[model samples]
Target: MPGVIARILRRTPDTRYAELADMRSGFNSLAAKVQTVLDKDPYGGNIFLFRGKRGDLLKAFYWCDGGLCLFAKRLEKGRFAWPRSDSGVVALTTAQLSLLLEGFDWRQPLDAARPRTAL
Candidate 1:
């Protein structure tokens, strides 16, 4: 998935944060809304990700293959952990973005395991 992730991250537009929006928002409404808030072209290839009002669903919009693509995911249980900012967008790192997509707490990453030898 690294290749796919690399492709998505390194597109025409840079990855960015989008304010929370309605889950029912479809292509047209979201495209226009996101464009307005971002001040960037929706079709310019930047991937805009938004959390749902209830925080259970996530919506992603971007341009791909000569068309616009909208990706949405809903968690069956826990809500997606989001930053404190709710009024506007907040930037996220690639690792954070990945963890967010995977429904994990990206804010605090776990430390790597360390092997120990005892005499």
Candidate 2:
């Protein structure tokens, strides 16, 4: 998770890993299928992530309190760097998920653009 997101979820339980699956499911569909198919409880408070076939869209499923929340993101320029495995599930750390969401390659998220001099 990024700084902002990390802070927001600071007190929340540890959701260190996100499940990456090749799914084009909507809110209601995912909420119903993820638990049984993936064998994961959506109400368990872990983050479940899914990517589109085109590699341009992403959806994150999370359980907050008693309800489920879905977050969707799409890249306008470059496609998101998705895992190259076949149709299956991949577990990613929070850091990797954050980089992926920002359009950066999660495998190599390096950005050293700090200012050398301060005014």
Candidate 3:
């Protein structure tokens, strides 16, 4: 399942966010906002991410399998890391998106320590 998500993200060129969005919005409203506010095609093969004003909630809108898909998450302990810009599209890589979803700082991820020997 994880591999599938990685593959999908790799194939997708546009993983973008609209800075802040209304978390109460449903699929139709988000689709409309994507079309009107961002000047983007709602049905286009791109992942659109939205963060709530409080910063703890996130919503992802995309087209998949002949239907629209919406994925939402709310951090129990911390807020999702976001870009500095207030309004506009912020492109993110698959790794960055994953880190952001896990409530980590995608901008400056700490380097993992190298192992002394390979097993």
Scored by lDDT, the top model is 3
lDDT of each: 0.75, 0.66, 0.82
Clashing residue pairs in candidate 1 are none
Query: Where does model 2 exceed 4 Å of error?
Result: 1-24, 85-87, 109-119
Every model's TM-score: 0.78, 0.68, 0.82
lDDT of prediction 1: 0.75
If the candidates were sorted by their lDDT against the true structure, best first, what order would they fall in? 3, 1, 2
For candidate 3, lDDT tens digit of each residue in 7-101? 55455667888868889999999999999888899888788999999999988888877988787878788888888865688788888887887
Query: Which residue ranges in model 3 land beyond 4 Å of their true spot?
Result: 1-11, 112-119
Best by TM-score: 3
| Candidate scoring better on TM-score of 1 and 3 | 3
Per-residue lDDT tens digits for candidate 2, residues 1-119, read 33444333333343422335456677677866666667767777877667776778777777787777777777788987876545456666666766777788877657889998997
Clashes of 3: 0
Instruction: Give the worst 10-residue stretch by lDDT in candidate 1.
Output: 1-10
Instruction: Evaluate model 2: give its TM-score.
Output: 0.68
lDDT of 1 by residue, 1-119 (tens): 33354346545445676767878898998888876887768887777888888898988788888998777778788988888765567766666777777788878778988768664
- Pairs with steric clashes in candidate 2: none
